[model samples]
Target: MKEADRCCGSAGSFSIIHHDLSMKVLERKISNIVTAKAEVVATSCPTCTMQLSYGLKSHGLTGQVMHPVQLLAKSY
Candidate 1:
């Protein structure tokens, strides 16, 4: 499997309007991804991507973040 998968945390205006709930959801996602031992994470949605990146950084995870297209481009 690829090193990372997209994080789904109700990204979009929902995140902005419900910061605490969004973060709670994101934290759970981060835990799962980290447990999977992924080295990188890529997402299609900008907001989801950024939020996941922030969560990873805040948790002191040593992982890289990239867009799905960016990751594909690099593989080529």
Candidate 2:
């Protein structure tokens, strides 16, 4: 595949109302994605994609983030 499919911890309103909890969940997702050695992250939701990009940068990961459709378009 292009990248690992992991939740960005932006559980709709959860992230907006619960910052700490969202960060915690995002940390876990980031850890898993890092362990997987993903070169990039592709997500469907705009909010989730943005949150994942932030998480990657915050965790010092060098992985790029994009939407699944974007990846597909690039591949073709």
Candidate 3:
């Protein structure tokens, strides 16, 4: 999570409009996640959740990606 504040490259329809560039940005974000060895990735944005989930799967990594609220709910 080194660049936890960085965008996941799914800003609204930006990913769809600029697929290639979006993937590049997502790759960087995913790289940081991998480096952190995160077991779960939490994000408030639905787009980021989707992108992160896809990125993990694409990398053949089985990490959970969820909304912060969903994770909090699971903690109970």
Candidate 4:
């Protein structure tokens, strides 16, 4: 989990300019998620939120992807 805070390659224009590279970076993140056996993935950024969701589906993971705000709102 050393690189847990590393980029997931959804850096706005960076992703658009480096589509292939972005996916490659995201793939690594997806692998980490799978390795951790996580049941859910949440984030504050809308872009990363989508990235994790797409990553989970693409990697055949059934984990849920959501925003922390959404969870908080649900708890209210």
* Selected candidate, larger lDDT, 1 vs 3: 3
TM-score of decoy 4? 0.84
lDDT of 2 at 12: 85
What are the per-residue Cα lDDT tens digits for candidate 4 across 1-76? 4366888888777778998999999998888887888787778888888877888888888998778888788779
RMSD of 3: 0.8
Preferred candidate (lDDT higher): 2 or 4: 4
Error of 4 at 30 (Å): 0.4
Ranking by lDDT: 3, 4, 2, 1
Measured with C-alpha atoms, the lDDT of residue 25 in candidate 3 is 95
The TM-score between candidate 3 and the true structure equals 0.95
Residue by residue across 1-76, what tens digits does model 1's lDDT show? 2223534566688888988888888878888778888888777778877888888899999887788789999999
Runs with alpha carbons beyond 4 Å of true place in candidate 4: 73-76
TM-score, predicted candidate 2 vs. hidden true structure: 0.84
What is the clash count for each candidate, in the order shown? 0, 0, 0, 0
lDDT score, candidate 3 = 0.93
Roughly what TM-score does model 1 have, to 2 decimal places? 0.81
Cα lDDT tens digits, model 2, 1-76, are 3234655679788898999989988888888787778887777788888788899988788898888889999999
Q: How many pairs in model 3 have backbone atoms within 3 A of each other, for residues 3 or more apart or on separate chains, i.e. clashes?
A: 0
lDDT of each candidate versus the true structure: 0.78, 0.81, 0.93, 0.82
